[model samples]
Target chain A: MRISVDSDRCVGAGQCVLSAPEVFDQDAEGLVTALTFAPDPGERDAVRQAVELCPSHAITVHDHGQGHSQGRDHDHGQGREDGRGHDGVVVDDG
Target chain B: MTGAQPRVVDFPLRRPGEPFPPPRYDDYRRHPGLVLSYLPNGNRVWLVTRHEDVRAVLTNKKISSNPDHTGFPNISDTMGVPRQEQIPGWFVGLDSPEHDRFRKALIPEFTVRRVREMRPAIERIVEERIDALLAGGRTADLVADFALPVPSLVISTLLGVPPADREFFESRTRTLVAIRASTDRQRDTATKELLRYINRLVAIKEKWPGNDLISRLLATGTLSAQEMSGVLMLLLIAGHETTANNIALGVVTLLLNPAWVGDGRVVEETLRYHSVADLVSLRVAVEDVEVSGQLIRAGEGIIPLVAAANHDAEVFTCPHAFDPARTERHHVAFGYGVHQCLGQNLVRVEMEIAYRRLFERIPGLELAVPVEELPFKHDGVLCGLHELPVRW
Candidate 1:
């Protein structure tokens, strides 16, 4: 799995690092720093959870098998049916 | 539906000096997203009690944070001060691109990295306050001696306010935040004085820039004098006020629940249990929207009872009990969505250091007066103790 972070949109909520510390860490300012763009198979699930829980939707994940990337643009103005967002992004409010 | 009018619960259901009332928790559990009429003004509003519903209302774009909208729920008469008449730069009341624009400019200054870099200084401030508290005999008013000053000094250091002016800003901010304690005239006077002081500081910064937030903002040349003053006032007041209360309240909570005194989870649980700014996050519906199966019409107001939502039994098991072991960190104590608090990371660091050091240094600390005898700040926008007299 490949991962990237949009530093411009990050508010440093620290959800990413909390969820997937192996793949993501925070700089001194609390902004997300991608420690590993390519994660081992064992770390994929945690990475996915981090991407979904990011409050700013700053984390993006491209699953090799899925052949598509998931990020902010993919989710439009619809609220998340599950009632959870990338960190607390509140998917429905977009 | 019956012909009888639906029960109208007061907007701010919690009373001063009380944990969120048990009945309110029951109300939230039973009616997660019920529309109830707010008292006094009688504005129709959705009382979002469930955590999920509260998140939905907070994050909904259709729900505007702009308090200028008609029919917006006003929890207190003091809060009803006209928007235009009130001091500007309170971005909490703005919506959309306007809120985003200002928030964007300020985000970099509060990033985790920046807060982490300041941790050493914050630790030093916390240590110094403890030192002062110890030197002042065996008894002290925790609020004045330690709780209030630690964050006050930290914020002053960050803003680059000269040490000589620290006492002035601190006193003004105390009056400004204590809406119930201070008369409206006093509030107005304090605000005007603070704004004038910031403006003078800004002019000085223009002539001789320094390595501080004010100088940095002036150097950008983005905000006008009034705008800059407004931002500084908001930061100055907000910087110390909430965290100060948290520190005091957190100590009281830890003393009551000694097992959780030094636990890191104590901070999260304290924030969740108290939810200090209980009724302030009022949003007006700018467009028709449905949340938690309720259709809220446009122009209606919504008040997310954060303390109630935090105690919702469905999300938190045994919600009423203070269980620091529970690891659910999704509490909306600092708010959520686009307007989630900008200084939350800093608050976490401050609280963690404050609690750890206080307990480690003064393990025998105990309240001098009974908790019931302590004065609780009821009239203010935030809920906290007026003074916590304590001894070791």
Candidate 2:
């Protein structure tokens, strides 16, 4: 599984870094960025916690077989039932 | 949705001779510690109305602001909303760790140095509004003309949004905070629109980084897209709305009590007496804690009534009266303890400039309408007059 951050929703609260320092780091302005991580089953819970703990509710994860667009598109306002997503950006799922 | 006893309640009963139904500080002092009150829903809450008790409750880490604990009322509980769903969650709602992180990150922008740098610009905005009010000629509404615009402009500038968006943000904020949005659809639509607007702005800032706070936020790698959006929403609500009400109500308080303006210490007293934010953002019981003699269990909600606390007779002499020299800094106007407002010093500077410039420039600014008829959104989170009509 791989973790991803929807930059649009990140508020840089730094909770993610506190929860999983191996996965995240905060920039000067307090926005969150993902760090290098070798995906492992043991880390799913950590990633999930980061996702849930985000005050901005801005993190998501996708498994290797699952297409990034398929698994996490529901978030970031993308792939909704109404089909409009993050800042109205339409995802092109082929 | 659960009908548990409200962790806290407002009895609506006030002592005799008080302007509002709730009793003044003196009444609470006669019966100190915690005052039990009831909400219409029948939730029993412990209201700490005295300065000592309010301070005790606020500083105690045992008092958690988080809502996950069943006994703790949601921060939005005052409005009676449940935790699973909330209107663009505010940072103030989070307990330590998350709360500390968000607040600390935003601290730089709200610092005295940073806020003071905006003073010239703030003064300019204040002057322009005052000028327009004068040009409009007699009977201008202070709320719209002076109070609202000052903080709205400051916050907009901080976010790099056009000042023109003030009307939209203001109306949206009113709907979110007002009691009239009885239907879920209405509330949802407002929340959705606000989220949509902030989302779009966040997107734009990502592409073209402006010098505003949003751009600074975009550059930070610490937050995810969703978190960034949440922060924007939080800033929109806390950064401007609260200050606007403070400015409006504070002005009204001074106008209603003319003697206040002349007092050598009107600034401090005005902040204490007519503090615009009636309640500090609610905090949850992090753990079982005791204030004075009462024990509040972990997860229970404790609302420190700053207005009531400011007037708590035990803390101050003649707590009900608007005395200019109360000789106390116990006022919870900006709240107390670890989360006391980061923007407070800036608020003081803004208020000082606002009052000083108004009196100095207008010379004899006074209310044009009777205090009773003045428009006040009675049920708003930040209680203040809708339109403070005033004339020179």
Best by DockQ: 1
Tens digits of per-residue lDDT, candidate 2, B1-392, equal: 12233233344333233454155444654564566665444554567777756666665657766555555544344444434333333566676666766665675576434666788988887888788878888778776667766776676677777667766765665555444434567666877898888788878888998888888766756677777777777676665657766677767777777666745466667777775565544666656666666766665666677777777666668766777776654477777654666566566767878887787788778878877777666555555666677888
Task: Please report the interface RMSD of model 2 to 1 decimal.
Answer: 13.0
Q: What is the C-alpha lDDT of each candidate?
A: 0.75, 0.62
Off by over 4 Å in 2: A1-94, B1-21, B74-89, B163-191, B259-264
RMSD of 2: 16.1
lDDT of 2 at B316: 66
Q: By TM-score, how accurate is candidate 2?
A: 0.70
Give RMSD to native, each candidate: 4.8, 16.1
- Give each model's clash number: 17, 44
Model 2's DockQ?
A: 0.02
